[model samples]
Target chain A: MNAPVPGTPEHFIANAKDRVFFAFDRSDLDESAVKTLMGQTAWLKTYPNTKVTVEGHADERGTREYNLALGERRANAVKQFLKAQGIADARVKVISYGKERPAVIGSNEYAWAQNRRAVTVVAK
Target chain B: MIKVLSRAWGRLGAALFAVALGVAGFSGAARAELRIDITRGNVDPIPIAIPAFGGGDEQSSRVGADLAGVLQADLERSGLFRGIDPRAFIQSFASMQVQPRFPDWQAINAQGLVQGRAEVQADGRLRVEFRLWDVFSTQQLKAQAYVTEPGNWRRIAHIIADAVYERLTGESGYFDTRIVYIAENGPATKRIKRLAIMDQDGANHRFLTDGADLVLTPRFSPSLQEITYMSYYNGVPRVYLYNIDSGKRERLGDFPGMTFAPRFSPDGNRVIMSMARGGSSDIYTMDLRTLERRRLTNTPAIDTSPSYSPDSQRIAFNSDRGGNQQLYVMNADGSGVRRISHGAGLYATPVWSPRGDYIAFTKIAQGRFFIGVMKPDGTGERLLSDGYLVEGPTWAPNGRVLMYFRQTPSDSRGRGGDSYLYSIDLTGYNERRVVTPVQASDPAWSPLIP
Candidate 1:
C-alpha cells in the first residue's frame, strides 16, 4: 500500500460525512441525508478511481426478513441520490444488513435513530 | 455442496412396539369424567394421581419412577393436569396394578389415576406399560404397552402421555414433538446465533450448527428430520437444508441474490423463500429434488416469509405491495392473490396451522409487536399477546397451541436484554415460558414424530 494522500478513502471519509440517518420505517432521504450525500458527491467526483458501496441498515422494530428489504431500500435510496449528483453507477454498489447489524446497542429511540442509517463505504 | 455425513440416519429401527393392553371392548361411548374443554379460553387443571410403575427389581423400579415422573411432568406442563403428591397416596403401585381403590384417589381429590409398570427384558430391552383410570367412574380409560431399547425410556414416556391426553381430551397431544430455533447469545451489536433443537419438554437440548456465521428463522419439515434455514456464510445469504438425524447439510439453491426466510412445503418436497434482487425482494419456490426454481410473486415491493397451508393448496405470506407490509393469500399456482390482513399495521411471518383452520402471524401495531392468529379468509383475527418485540409464532403439532420468542428491551448501554421462548394456548389462556439453555428466538415446532 502507498502512503496516505489527500484523495485516499480515509481522506474522503474524514472530509465528507459518509453516513446518513432515516426515520422509522421510512426510506425517503431527508434534507440532512441529502447534505451528507452532497458532501460525498464532491469527494467521489474528485477521486475517479474510488468506488463507494452504500450499506443500508434498519432498527429492530420489524421482523428479520422484512428489515432486510427495508435496509436495501435505504441503501438504494442513497445510491439513487449519488447518481443524481453526477456520481456514475459503476463507481457505487449497495448492500443491506437489515436489523442484523445495528450501529447502536441500546433498545431506546436514541439508539434506533442511529441504527436506522445508510453508510457510504469507500471500497479498497 | 452435497456434503454427505453417512447415510441412513434413523431411529430405533423396527424394534419399538406399542400395543393396547386389555383393549378388548374398550368403551368408545364412555364420557370423560375428568374432561377439559380445550376449545374454551381457560379451564382448571385436572388433578391426577400418578403412582410409580411397579417393577420386579431395583433398576426396573428406578426406571418406573422416572417414567411416572416424566409422564406427570408432561401433563402438568400442558397446563391441563395437576399431579397429586405421591406421599399422600393410600395405595401402593403393586396394589394399583390389580385395581385402584377409588376412594383412596377421591380422598386426594384426584379425578384421574395413572398406573404403569416397567420390567427389564432378557435381551436388555425395556417394557413399559401404563393404564389410565377414572377415579370416580372406576373404569380403565386407556392402557398401552411399549417395548423398546433400554435408553429409549424418555420417548416412551412421552408417547404414553400422549395416549392418556388423547383419551381424556378429544385432540392429539404435542408431547412427542421437537422445537427447532435460533439460540442467540453475545452482545446486542454482534449476536452469535446457532441452530438448536430440543424436545417439547426442554429435554435433549443440542445445537445443530456452530455459530461461525449468522443464522436465522429455522423451520422444520412437516414430515422429515430436515429443517430449512438461512445463513450468511461467506457474507452471502443462502438457504440451507440440514438433517437433524444424519448431521448432513447442504445449500438449498444457488439463486441470483440473497435467498432467505426459507420454509419447507407442508409435504417437505420443496422450499419456499424470498430472494432479494436490488432494492426489493420477491417470493420464490425451489423443488428440493430437481433444484428447479419458480417465482411465486412478481413485484417491485418486498414479498417474503411465504408459508403454505396444511394442504399445500394456498400460500399465506407477508408483502408490501399494497404500500404497507400485511398478510396476503394466493393460490398454489400463484393465481388469485388477495390481501388477508386489513389491520392498520404491519404483519409478518404468516404460519398456517397444521390443522388448516387458522394462520398464525406476528403483527406490529402502534410501537408494539404482537403474536396473533387469523382465519384463512382473514376473519376472526385475534391477538394472543403483545410486547415490546414479540415475534415468530410457531404452532404446535396439535395446532392447539403456539410457541414464540419474546424479547424485552435493553437499557441504554444494552445491559438487560432478555429473550425467552413462550408457549400460549390457541384460546389465549395458558401463557407459559418454555425453558431454554440460552436466549432463544424463531421457534418452529416439528410435526408429531411417527
Candidate 2:
C-alpha cells in the first residue's frame, strides 16, 4: 500500500492517531495527554473542513453516572484545548459514553489504563 | 395495616396454653411471647412449620398449597425464619378450624406454626384466614383474614406473609415491594440497556423501556407510580421522568449540557440531579411543579449522586472536590458543607437509609469495590460486602436490607461475563443473590405499594 499524499484527509487522519489518556477519577489532561492533543491540533488545522467528535470514556472503576460526568469533562477538555489552539469549536463535537464504551475490556490495571481515554473520531 | 383480631375461642385457647406453660415460671412468659429479636438479624433462622391449608374446594385447595409455599418463601427469604421440611411433620394441618397438636410440632423442634383456611365465597372471591401460633406455648400470636378475587392469589399470599413477618420480627415486611433496575444485553462495548422492574421476590419481571438509547441510574420516587432516571435519548444525557402507568415521558429541564445521577426528593416533589457545564459537573435540584432549578453544589469538581435524607432536611452526596471521590453532607438548601467520608478509599453513591440511621455507599479501595454503610457523621464505617465489582446500594423500604449489583470480570475481549443483583442484611450477616431475568445493575427499591 502506497503512503497517502501529504496534507490529504487520509494523511491528516493518520497523523491523528494517538488518543489521550487520563488518571483514575480525573478528567484533567496530563502532560502526555496534552502532548498528544498538541500533535492532533496540527492535523486538525490542516484539514479545515474536517469535523470530529471527541468521544470521552472512563475506566470501569467508578459509578456509571460519575464516570459519565468524568467522560464529559475529558471530552470537553480535548475540545476546548483544540479550540484554544485555533480549531473551530463548531467542528469539535463532544459526546460522553462514560464507562459505557471501553476501548479495552478487562478488569486489570492494564485494561483500565487503555479504557480510560478520549478518542477523536473524524465525523463523516 | 390490618390489626390482628383474635377470635374469642382463639383467645381462650391461648390463655389456657399460657397457664399450662406458667408451671415452668421463668420459661412461661418468654416462651409464650411470639416476638423474635431481629436486632442482629438472627443468622440461625427460627424453625417454622407451615402445613398445607384446608377447607378449600379442588381449585381452591391447589391455590391453598401455592399460598402456603409463597408464604414459606417470603419468611425464609427474610433470613428470620426457616420453614421446616414438611416430611418431618408428625401432624398434618387437615383443618384450620382445629388447633394443631403442639406435642407433634415440639417433637420436630418447630418453634412457630402457620395454619390457614381458604374458601370460595358466593361472589367467587377467595377468603383467606390465617393464624400464627407459638408452637411451644401453643399461643395464637396473630389471626387475620383477607377477601380478594381468586386471580390475585399471590398478593394475598404476600399480605399474609407480611402479617406473619410483622408479628414475628416486630419489623415491617419488604416482600410486597418491587425493584427497578437496568436490564442489560449485548456486549460491553455496544451494550443495550432497558429499564426493568420486578417483584421483590424476582417474579413478574417486565421491561419498562425499549433499548433504543442508553439509560442509567434509575431511581424510584417516594410514590411508586413515577420513576426518575438519566437517559441519553437524543444523543445528550438528561434527566427524564417516566410515568409507569400512563406510559408518558417528560424531560425534567432543558439543560444545555448533560444531566445525570438523578434522584427524587423524599416527598417526591422535586428531582435532584447533576449537570455538567464548562467542563465540570455540579449538583442541582428542580421542582417538578414549577420547573424552578436550584443549584446545590457550586464546586468546580464533579459533585453528583445527591440523595435526600428521609426527613428531607439534609442531603448526602459524593464529590471529588477533595481531590478524589468522597462522601459529603450538606443541607437541603446546600448550606454547611462538610466532608463525611475520611476513609482511605474513594466513596461514591451515598444513599441515606429510609430509617435514617445509616448512609450506604460504594467504596473502591485497593482495586476492588465494596458496599458499605456509615453513620451520617461518617464514623462507625462498616463494609457490608465486597467483590470485583459491587455497587449501587439501595435500601429496602424498611431499611433493614440493602440490594446492590455485582459483576464478574469478562474475558479480555469483554465476553462471557455476567452481572447479578445481591441483597445483604443491614447488620451485614446474610448476603444472598437476588435473581434477575437478565444482567442487572443500578437497583432502586420502591416504597411499599399501597
What is the per-residue lDDT of model 2 for residues B338-441, given as tens digits with 9 covering 90 to 100? 99999898999999999999999999999889999999999999999999889999999888999999988877977655778999998887889898878999
TM-score of 1: 0.94
Worst 10 residues of 1 chain B by lDDT: B1-10
**Model 1, A36-66: lDDT tens per residue?**
9899999998888899888889999999889
Individual DockQ of the candidates?
A: 0.70, 0.65
lDDT to native, each model = 0.87, 0.84
Residue pairs that clash (backbone atoms under 3 angstroms), model 1: none
TM-score of chain B of 2: 0.92
Candidate closest to the true structure, highest lDDT: 1
Candidate 2 share of real interface contacts = 0.72
- For residues B59-109, what per-residue lDDT tens digits would candidate 1 score against the true structure? 889999998899999999888999999999998867334767778888988
